[model samples]
Target: MEYKNNGHIRVFLVGHAISPNRGSEPGNTWNWAWELSKYTNVDVFAYPQHRKEIEKFILEHPRNNLRFHWVTLDNFDPWHPEKGESGLRFHYILWLRKVYKIIKNLIDNMQEPIVVHQVSWSTVSTPPPILQGVPIVWGPVSGGQVAPASFRDFFGNAWPKEMVRSWRVSFYPLILGWGRRVSSLPLILAVNRETEALLRKAGAKRVEFFLDCGVPSGFGLPKPQEVARPPGPLRLLWAGRLDFIKALPLVLMALRRVRVPVELLVAGDGPLKLQWQSAVQRLGLSDKVRFLGRIPWDKMKEVFQEAHAFVFTSLRDGFGCVVLEAMSFGLPVITLDHQGVGTFLPADAAIKVPVRTPEETFQAISEGIERLALDEDLRLRMSREAWRFAQEERWDRRAERMLALYEEVLSHAHRRV
Candidate 1:
């Protein structure tokens, strides 16, 4: 895994998807790929053919210093006639082994210092421990946003698992075995403190901190001159999935008695779409809210521009990228301070509320929003400061930090020789 000094920092990033879908999961891969491609000669190694149009369009329009390598896997689709036709876990195993072998071959072929950044979760195989000697970065690899009940104490309520066969899944036999085993890999570059902590709990050593999400520009907010009386009370904005773990109802319950006007704009959609609509109707505060369904990328800025503050009340988040996007808009953030989302936010830029009872959630939102709404001066000040911080946190910064970490490690590996 050692390398010579003169070669390009050839990066091999593996992920489930790089297209950056609306969900948090896709953001994890896309953000990292787009950022990393900026600093190094990079190539993305992804799953079998996803969409033909995307594949063809991307192949023809590759970015500078970046390439795409699609590793076709015999994906297990029950409805497909070819499903189980492989007669073994051959495709899955071969996919993992062949990809690594390809990376090793690439190193040999190009004489480049290879960095295998493996996005580990429930499916993708953990890179061989020996690959760590080559400066590998591990994940924002959240297989599912909703944790099973066993992990509920740490991950909040049981997460949505419509595709994961429910909590009937045995942790030891499946996820924990693979994910923990992967975490135990030496010299893993982790995304956040919570992830690092989890890896440590899983016996991970030689790990370093990294921010997985990308915060794009335009810290949008209503103009001071245009906004009158700040809409009274605490005007709040909470965006993300409408799923159960999102704790949308909990956020609603918390803001129930607040004196300020609390607004929760449910942005993304999921299985719990109907339930959220029902809850909103029952709450009788529909006037204070709006559900801008599946917002287009170009219009997200307009939405962020309208809000005063971003509130995230998810039970567990793997580096809440949306909060970063919110901060980029210079909206002050108030979020749960346990597990994933809490880890990515810098304390000075946002409000971190402890994940205690639902009461605390209510208190934080009610009071926090009012404080911002009433004090125009405070909003202006925080907005300016928030954007300043967000500017420094552009995905390029994250990519550079990772590159520096990789170069440092690679240098040491070479010196030891």
Candidate 2:
């Protein structure tokens, strides 16, 4: 609880993206910097693309302890498609080199100790920072989850790409000599079980499991004493980028088997939008499903509030942040029992269907949905549990965990010296 001693501890947070206007990794970077500033002085190094949004937010709600530094390469865009994936990787490495020089210069002149925490672009494949004499905390990182082979048919034309990805995840560490680099880290935080297992297998000495996503402190506070069901047919919400990995078709197929009146609101937009829209008609679900493309982040709460339950069908994810957001709004979740959802979501708060044969999985999903639709008592119970679980994962609590990790790593570094 006592984060400040004689003065606040200084932290240099290295992340590629940090912005209040975005979600996922960019929002994650901003959240870590903002929340950690409550307990420490944070100097954030991020890409220049988010500069305007960050500045506007800071001007409106200034924090003396929080500062942002823009870091990028000259005449190079890391996200440019022409550069290709390899080019983007090279650009990230170059950007990080520039950040290292800045941090090294500051440390040479400063009297107080500093800690470097890389909070975003959370992937184990990326090279760790080379900051000697300064304590480093890597991750709550992910990228180890892979699509199941049993469900390869669901990926359609993307199956070949998925196969290549699965191969890379399994061997890239050894091929790139990440084993040596990872083993040297003082502390490495993993976001899911697969990532944690992979890190440990790669010879990491100290790896801790931690979720990469969290809700805001005031999110769903003053929990309602009673769960109120909206007067209508069972309303289910499925939200995510309409990507192949999301496997939206699983839910669509399952809906055909459900024996109850239910409506599914699909919220998001991506490459598969038109294709999935076609599938909805093909499956004869046009009457039961509505595609609400790309809802704004602030307005998503309205969508969640209207839904009776949340459905997560991500074949792979670091952790589905939207699942937590749905839970915060008192929606019981029905999700696949694998990856982050399988590892972190409380059994009491969700009905997790196992990853089995396609028909079996679809049937189970249908049964799960129908069960929740018919049993009001079960839905309310799970809703209360889901809300309670979300409250515990608030950003403030995650920040406390980070502060403690920083102290632990710093103490160990001092003992080694």
Candidate 3:
């Protein structure tokens, strides 16, 4: 397994959204970088806002193999996005330009060649440095997922903003001419089937469906149960940003149809918070559902342990890490049979229903909920399978897979030379 240069492979990783050790918050950029550093020397180019958090993590958990190069954006705070992501896209493009310049200079002076790894937002049409002659790896990119036509039709002619965003993805190949770049890429790691197809259509030489999401180490550590409380109703949990794409309204509709008495714990907040709460009252589900807005990341474990099942209603997601985390807590997931939710969960781990119409989606969800409520044995079996799947998806295993792909790309490049 010795590399061509006979030492640990050095990687110039370009990831703008990396926040090391921020588990409770979203984004898995830190986990991917940190885990890979165990197998390779990674010099990361990330935004400056993560500097304090990264510094704190480095101080507590030392790793000599990893180095952080903060790519600062002057006077502008893109991370906060308080202005509704108005200039976020432009800001990232400009930031990547700076990253390219830095890497281009470093690559010229380096003694040994290094691989350029673009972690997330692995668009085929990226900045120039990513397309250079050096062996390049782009992945876990999340662009091609589109919401079901049924979802869009039910919502209205206007189309939810998410659907509009998906439409924009179609222009990538035409505008960026990504196929030209894909023809030369050493490796392309797509997160979902839609992205895989898009990459292939873009003429990618080698494309692999690779998941870039995982929980932190010891994430599923079990705690003693407090089973002394008198059980009254079945508890269901749904946690994520309260956005249109999450399809929170559809979940509420499904809850209205459930035959058994059930209580739902909703964690997290977003722009649609007021609308969702109003919908609960409109549907007379005020008593059945409770909104615990923006629960702390550490406290999510307690919420998952209390629930018998996790119902995910996201119409389209690049990769749903929460679904996997719910599985780690031994909760059987009930989700639609599409996108990341369908891609990540095995048949045994979840009660996946088709997503064609609003009524159909909610009806299937209601039946799945009732099935879990009426059948204890079925729930137990599914929970066991979910936990098993989560164990198999640990971060270390994903890291090993990623490093192996890097080695393959580099060795192949060497052989060609």
Winning model by lDDT: 2
Q: What TM-score does model 2 achieve against the real structure?
A: 0.93
User: Which digits, one per residue and each the tens of the lDDT, describe model 1 over residues 227-293?
Assistant: 3334444456777777766777766766666675556676777777787778777888677767777
Rank list by TM-score: 2, 3, 1
Q: Superposing every Cα of model 2 onto the true structure, what RMSD results?
A: 2.4
Clashes of each: 9, 0, 0
TM-score between model 1 and native: 0.77
In model 3, which residue pairs have backbone atoms overlapping below 3 Å?
A: none
Collision pairs in model 1: 146-159, 219-328, 219-329, 220-329, 233-260, 234-260, 234-369, 234-370, 254-362
Q: Each model's C-alpha lDDT?
A: 0.61, 0.86, 0.77
Model 1 vs truth, CA RMSD: 5.7
Model 2: per-residue Cα lDDT over 1-417, one tens digit each: 434544447899998877887888788888899989987789999987778998999899999989888877778655664555666777787888788888898899887778898876788887575567787789888899999999999888989999999999999567546887788789999888898888888888798988888997566535832755866689999999999899999999999999899999999999999999999999999999999999998889889987899999999898889999999988899999988889898999999998988888899999999999899898999999999888778888888888888888888888999
Tens digit per residue, CA lDDT, model 3, 272-298: 899889989999999999999998878
